[model samples]
Target: MSRVSILALALGLAASSLALTASAATPSANTPSAAITAAIADVNRPQADRDRDGDRKPAEMLAFAGVKPGDKVVDFMPGAGYFTRLFAKAVGPKGRVYTLLPGELATRSQKAVDGQKALAQDKAYGNIVPLVQPVNAPVFPEKVDVVWTSQNYHDLHDAFLGPADVAAVNKAIFDALKPGGVYIVLDHAGDKGSGLRDTETLHRIDPETVKKEVEAAGFVLDGEDDALRNSADNHSLKVFDPSLRGHTDQFVFKFRKPK
Candidate 1:
């Protein structure tokens, strides 16, 4: 090859390599999923909220849930607006995040209603809509793309739910989602054979039980993510136990409404 042509080709290859390196180092504006990027860049997020990211794996969990911009999501029992704020931002301006305050929880503690109401009025979470309803007769204004419940599924059996017909709650959720919608459940894991034995005391439920109950609602188990799992947890201690408070082993399950 001519010397000029050879040099030109070498320069072209070097430029291509640099471009590729730059692309890899700095993801394009379109590269990181909107949901993932928003969760990371949410400056209004409190320091205490950021502090829990290590253990809660909010980014990983949202990615697993397949959350995206312009999606309508329901943050089931959005206690203290933790994931509520993230979901609100994840869905962006065109989308909406409904933070549910079940009557069972609200009637028991006015704090639940007050907290969610405060979030609804926050200009930072402009896309959040507070949904207040009785646990047994829960409903949504419109079908949603995703219904997410984090660290609170076992509460279905809590006395506060009072003869809680978990089936009804599940059915209400099933009815409120689009045919192909997603349901993401993240909760502390109980021992393999524990069943509901420890839910009230230890605040943990067997992953198998959760799957079975959710599947019975006519939803299919789409996938499971162990990003928050910790094999070190023995499943005996309460999730609130001082030793395992933030390190409890948890399971993340994704269920899909049949299309």
Candidate 2:
């Protein structure tokens, strides 16, 4: 073959190989499993939560977290039992979901605490356990399979809830998980290079800050997805502000403790 013909052939082969690698790495989001579907469709889930399903993407998030029957999960700071209830149903009868409520959050939002306790009593989601304790010290019932915290990850640094010793909490979470277990942190994103500065005012955190703190505890950054990201959000307003409440730009990160 001529030199130009040989070069084109080599480039095409490299492109084909790269395509195969990309295809292999991507998980199938189009087809959710039976367990995840049932959990999202559970009749007992409050309508309010169901309404927000489009924005929160619970099924996608659960599938991303790889929750399965018989897996033990720690829904860290599971406010209002939103993800907590979904987790309880997803894990099924053989599995368990611990709603890890901090003593600080209980003081801040008693209604959330009471709601969690009530769900634990209901037979439908009986697999839930409300584990309340100090923010810095996390004592899980058993080394868990997954420890997930949503929008509230930034609160661990805020004055209202924490100014919490984040390193201590991350270390505690590290110790509480089984080797190979996953730690998923989903939160709103602050502006570029802001680091932890926006956490208190915007209730948003720089994704880099989360990675640094989590990796310090010996966890590896496993995966991340843009499923919840909204490009329109500039990340300046508070997460709870009227215009930004449900549509804020968010990030989903999955970290794992190595075996």
The TM-score between candidate 2 and the true structure equals 0.88
| Candidate 2 structure quality by residue, lDDT tens digits, 136-184 | 9878779999999998899898896758999899999999999999999
Q: After superposition, how far is residue 99 of candidate 1 from its true place, in Å?
A: 0.8
Error (Å) of candidate 1 at residue 20 is 15
Q: What RMSD does each model have against the real structure?
A: 5.0, 4.3
Weakest ten-residue segment in model 1 by summed lDDT = 27-36
lDDT, candidate 1, 82-187, per-residue tens: 8888888888899999998788778778888899999999998899999889887787899899999988899898775674788988988999999999999999
Give the lDDT of residue 167 in candidate 2: 89
Looking at candidate 2, what is the lDDT of residue 170? 93
- Residue 94, model 2: Cα distance from true site in angstroms: 0.5
Q: Flag clash pairs in model 2.
A: none
